[model samples]
Every structure is written in C-alpha cells, then in structure tokens.
Target: MVDFYPLARKAEVLHVPMEVYLMFRAAGGPDILGQSAAVSLLDWFELDTEIIIVMERPSPSMDLVTYSTLHYPLPEDTVRDIMRQLVLAVIDLHNKRVFHRDLKSNNVLIQETEDGIRVRIISFGCGCIVSTIPYTSFTGCLSCAPPELFLERKYMDSPTSVWQIGGVAYELFNEDSKFFNTYEWFIDALGMKTSITASEEGKHFIQVCLEESPSKRISLEELERHPWFFTTT
Candidate 1:
C-alpha cells in the first residue's frame, strides 16, 4: 500500500506527519519487521509537497470491517483466535514502545491462510510512542474512543488500547457495529445492561476491557492469559 501525505497542511513545520512518524519507527529498531500483527513499512520518501510511503500489500485481504460485515456474529472460536492475535500484536507494540492510538476494525487487514485467518494492524496516523506521561490529544473513531479519552481528554496508552480491543471483540461476537452509540447501546453495555446481552464469558471479557477506571482496565498481558482463548478447545 502506498500512502501520500501532503505537507502543505502543516506548512510551518514543513514535515509530513506520516513521514516523521515513519522515521521514528525506522529509528525505533528493526523489531517491527518481525511483528506479525503490524503492517510492514517498505520504503518512504519526501517530495516537494508530499510524503510517499510504500508498504507491503497483503494480497487477497480485506479489512476487518468488511470481513465482519460479510460474516457477522463470527463463530466463538474464530473470535477467540482473532482476539488472541490482536492481543499478541498489542503486546509486541507495547514492548517496542509503539502505541497504536487508533486501533479499529476499519484499518485491521484480514486475510485467510491455510491454517486460519491473519490480522494486521494498520493506520499509524494516530499512533505514538509510549511514555511515562499521559496523552492529552485523541484521534481515531469516536465510537471506538475510550471513555477516559472522551471525558478527561487524558489517557494512558495501555488502558485506552484495552478499551478498543474489548469494543472490537464485543462487536464481532454480537454482530453489532454500533460501538460508538455511546448515547444508548454503549452506555448499556458498559453498565452490563440487561437489554444488551452477550455470552457470560463475552460479557466478562467486555467488562474487563471497558472498565471506566483506566487503572483497573485489563492489561495486554492479562488479556493474553484470559480464559476466553482456552474455551475454544
């Protein structure tokens, strides 16, 4: 995939946001290349007014959104596998000091393999590095945005990511895409609202992800060890 970023928007800095972002990744280390969950960056160059980025194209792949829309309410085992991969990816990113602030179904590429399905996280436009300090600015889909980000505009990398992951999991399992319908459905889901239901395991998992208190939210490590993945057997 080739992405073009116009530098004219932020003429003062004269640096393309994406170009700078890629530069950081390039400097961060070569570990990204080994991460199965992230889309690999191939090459990037700067033009007069645009930054061109070349990335690996995952052939015969569709985004998770399309996949889910076509195959909503995916089987429990399928969802478990998907979450396992995603959690593994997030763990890798966190370990590498990269935070994908904008993780949603739209940018997650999905391709079927001989063994199973593969998922790659894309769209680093809203991503940043992990820091001891909290981030104040937020990006990505409002529906997938965590409550802490919306309410306080301040969020930590790990907890916020947990929320999105949980939201995606719930959406896939329930075949409901109104993740951002915070006014009604989301509010209910957070409350474990009786009207909006899921499997007992599903509900427990979602609750852990959507915990209102960021500090109490499930960590990537904890999620990886969750019982949900073991249920498939």
Candidate 2:
C-alpha cells in the first residue's frame, strides 16, 4: 500500500498478480507449470474506482510464520523440506519471467492435508516481470529486502530474490534474524545472532544465499541442486 502508482498506471501495477497468472497460463497453463506452487486466479474484473480479483481459498492452512511459531526451532529435515519446495517455486516463477520481489515467510502458506505439508507462495502485489535492468524502486518487504538496496540503492531480479530466500531460511534457523536492518544482518560465517544449530552443508547454503556480492551468491539452479537439499530430506 505504500508504493502508489498513478491512476493511469494502475493496470500495470495492480494487474501484476493477474498478469503473472496469465503468464503462467500462457505458459501452457498451471497444469503444465504445476499449480502446487501458487494459488489459482479464478477470475478478475475492473470497475471505475476499484478492481476485484478472485483467487483460490485453500482451507486448513496457515501462513509460514504461524506454522514456524507453532513449531519453533524446526528440525533440519523440516527446514530442508520447506526450502527445497520454496526454491523450486522460485525457479518456476523466474523461468516464466516472473520476479516475485516480495517472498517473505508471511507471504508463504503451509497447507496441511492427506498429502502432507504443501508450501504455496501467496501475495504477488509487489511482483514484476523479470528484466535485465536493475529496479530502483522498492516494492518488497523491508525485513527480507536485499542488502544491495541499502548499499547500492539498486538491485536486479535473480540476486534479490535469492537473497530473500536466504533471509527466509536464516529466520527459520535464527529467530533473532527477524525484522533485521542492513547493518544487523550476518557478519561472518553464521549470523551474529545465531540461534539454532544446523548442519555444515545447510549453514553453507544459507551463507551463500546471503552473500553480499550478487556474483558470489547462489544461483537458482545451483540452489535447487544444492547439497544441503539432498543431505537430509
């Protein structure tokens, strides 16, 4: 709600979720893309002053924050499970040229059913189509924002998103990592406010994600095949 676009530019911004859905649709529909990652956009309509968007309602579910709180100090296996699914979903989005700028845990949903815990990334209000050019504006959540935004004042697509994933993982292990500012992030190998003890590979993976230099950070493909992913669950 903080970032406001002119009324003339409403469609471009407000329609982000719908456009992304259509893009996923244009990519041979969700059936091909795997609808498990995101919620289905049932329909949409536009009026004079406002627009209405209808989306799927997955019941018996809760946001990741709530889930994590209920099960604080998540086991390495659970963290690996969650991160693996998250990485795949992000890869899917980027492959389709959709950049989910806002990817904090709050925006992710964990659905419980006979199928087990399913992670669904929600809230595309701050999303944008992928681009090579760096974005100057900040539509993402501040808590999980990339460090480059505070340092260089600009960030690209993949790097920032990867950093966000790292931030999520870090918070899962280190509760003190929440609502962290730029200076309050990690210092050395592990975070300064280290809480939980994780495996070496897991720690390495998280560190790589939070790497300050985008060039050194883990790429989405590398992140998917990351050793930590297969080490446990």
Candidate 3:
C-alpha cells in the first residue's frame, strides 16, 4: 500500500465531468472501467506523489465531481527535465511490466520544489498491468492515442506511451498541440498544410516516436539520447 499526501492544503476547484465515463458506460464497459483504473496504474509505477495532488475538495455543485489546482504551469526548461525524469520512470515501470494506457497533459502534474521541478504522472483510473489487460478496452486521450489503438484491434501497448510522449515533446517545445486546437485542423496540419517543422534531428526523433507501427517507435532509452534533449540544456 502507498501513502498519498496532500500537496496543496487548499486550492480552487474546477468541475467538468469527463465524457469518458458516459461514453464507456454506454459502450458496455470498454477495456478499462472508471477513473480508478487510471489511478491504480499510476500507483503501480510508484509515480503517484503528493506533488501531483493539489487538494481534494468536494463539489456538490456538480454531480459526481472532484477538483484540485496546481501551483503553477510547468516551465519549458522544467518540462525538458521532467520529460527526462518521466522517460526513466516510464522505462522502470515497463521493466516492472506495467503500462500507462492513458498518457496526456491532464493526467500528468508538476510541482515546483526547492530542489527542482517535481513531476507526477497521475490518473491510473484506467491503468492496468500488461498481462491482465483490462476487459474495458481503448482508453486514452484522442490526440495522444496512437493510430493502432483506434483501429479495430482495441488493445494498447508500450508504444502508445511513445506516441503520447512525442505529443508532449511537441507541446513543450512549440507551446501548442495539433490536438488542442481542432481535430480537423490538426488533421489538416498533419497532412502538410502547416508551417511548423523542427530541425532534422528533432523532426526525426518526433517522427520515430509518433510512428504508427509500435515496432518502429523509438524506445525510451533511445529517446534519452536524442539531440533535442541534449540541445535543450
């Protein structure tokens, strides 16, 4: 059992019932069930820290809701550091045979500490061990999800993390996401209508990380050595 401490004793609340519950419940319990699964997954990795939890406040105003707020937005330089930490943390989780089926900014949290930026990947409510493989299938943020996950197969693996991490890297460096603006716009941008383009090394790294085929995606260890990371420092 792990102990969860409160990061912020008091914080503002934002209540927005996620659509995943309604959509999955209507679908007859897709791969994973409820937010607990996501919370559980993060626990297995031992990445659930107080730094990730601002405060847990009851919100009777909204039906079935909870809210918390962080101290500040993660800085760009700090984002790079946390990305490195996450890469190592993720590799360790995989070694333990766990997979974070759902990876997204909303699911990740950051805390500023005297030592440095502390990161905690939260919301394992949809998390599952690689072997158990939840009966509730297809859990992930639409933008970060790899193409294969959306296909008829309905199963996700480690590479899913790679793609999502790629999306994170793009967001951290560019301050925008293809998925955040508009679905159609993101699609059109991916189709080569956008002016955005990273350097050769950065482009190659992102491309490999976002590869549709899991086999082609770069491993976390490989990502550690990417020039983008080194160049940032």
Candidate 4:
C-alpha cells in the first residue's frame, strides 16, 4: 500500500506510520488472523513537498469498517468470532510492546478466504510504544478513543485499547451505530439501552470493555477467556 501525506499538514516531518512499520518488523513480523502485517518497507521519497511511503500491499482485502458496514448487525456468532480474532491481534501487539493508538475499524484490513475470514492491522500512523508511560498526547479516531483520553488527556495502554475494542464491538453488534458521538446518547446506551438485543453475557462483555475506569476495564487475556467467545459449536 502507498501512503501519500501532504507536507502542508504539518510544519515538521512526522514519519510515525513508517516508524511503526519498522517497529512491527523488529517485533518478530507477526501476522494477525492469517493476514500479514506491515511487511518490509518498500520505498520512501519526497516530491514537491509531499511525502510518499510505499509498503507491501495487502491485496484482496477490505477494511473492517467496509466489511461491517456491508454486513451490518452481523449475527452474534459472527460477531463473537470476529471479536475473538481482534482481541488476539491486540494482545499480540501489546506483547510486542507496540501500542496501536489509532485502533479503529478502518485500520483493520479484512480478507475472506475459502477457509474463513481473516484480518491484518494496518495504518499505524498514530501508534506508539507502550513503555513510554504517561501518554498525555492523544491521537486516534475521536469516536473510538477512550473516555479517559477525552476526560483526563492521559491514559494507560491496556485500558485505552480495551475501550477501543469496545467501540469496535459496539459497531459490530449495534448495526454500525457509534458509541461516543453524543454525551446523552452514550449515557443512555451505557445504561443498558433498550435497543440492545444481545444476550446478557454478550452485553457484559461489551460493558467490561467500555468500563469508565481504566483500572477496572477488562484485560485482553481475560477477554480471551470470556464465555462469549467460547460458546458451544
């Protein structure tokens, strides 16, 4: 994939996406859900104040946003399956000390095969290292960002990621409805909104992911063990 960024957007060069691709390579070049991540960097150049970054193309794929929008309100089983893979992908990134700060549906590339649907995380433009503590600078899709990011301007890695995962879950099960656009609507949704038709366990899973307090949010490891992901076949 080729990324073109106009230099006019910022006064100084910010090659965060390229840096993240390099970081992913250094961290064992992992693949999530059978799709490869930012592979070897292809090329980089500047032309007339525009920066171009060339990367290995993840062909024959669509983003999660596009896929979900096409198949809105996916079945509970399908949602559980997709969420399981997504959680595992996030866990892999966290274990490698890489924090994909801008984790939204658009950043996840989805590919369907005869075997099954798979995914690869892309667009690391806003990613950062997890060890770099006290992240006061917030960067990511505003709607998917955690409450702490909006409320305190600082957030921990695990909790913030959990919140973003919850946002993804919301879109998956809520017919592409966003979670945090308006304060009143969000409050109503959080209070177990009437429109929610998911099972109690499913609701609990999302609720844990959207926990207001970082310390209280569900960890990826715990999420992996959640019953929703282990329903009888």
TM per model?
0.81, 0.82, 0.58, 0.79
Candidate lDDT values, in order: 0.70, 0.74, 0.49, 0.68
* Pairs in clash, predicted candidate 2: none
Q: RMSD, each candidate, Å?
A: 5.9, 5.0, 12.6, 6.4
User: For model 2, what is the alpha-carbon lDDT of residue 189?
Assistant: 33
Q: Which residue segments of model 2 deviate by more than 4 Å?
A: 1-34, 175-181, 186-193
Positional deviation of 156 in candidate 1, in angstroms?
0.4
The lDDT of model 4 is 0.68
Candidate 2 lDDT over 204-225, as tens digits, reads 8888888888888889999999
| Candidate 3 overall lDDT versus native | 0.49
Q: Which stretches of candidate 4 lie over 4 Å from their true place?
A: 1-23, 26-41, 46-50, 179-185, 190-192
Candidate 2 has an lDDT of: 0.74
By TM-score, the candidates rank as: 2, 1, 4, 3
lDDT by residue (tens digit), candidate 4, 11-34: 755443445343434232323223
- Lowest-scoring 10 consecutive residues by lDDT in candidate 3? 58-67
Candidate ranking under lDDT, highest first, comes to 2, 1, 4, 3
**Candidate 3 deviant stretches above 4 angstroms:** 1-76, 132-136, 152-156, 175-186, 189-200
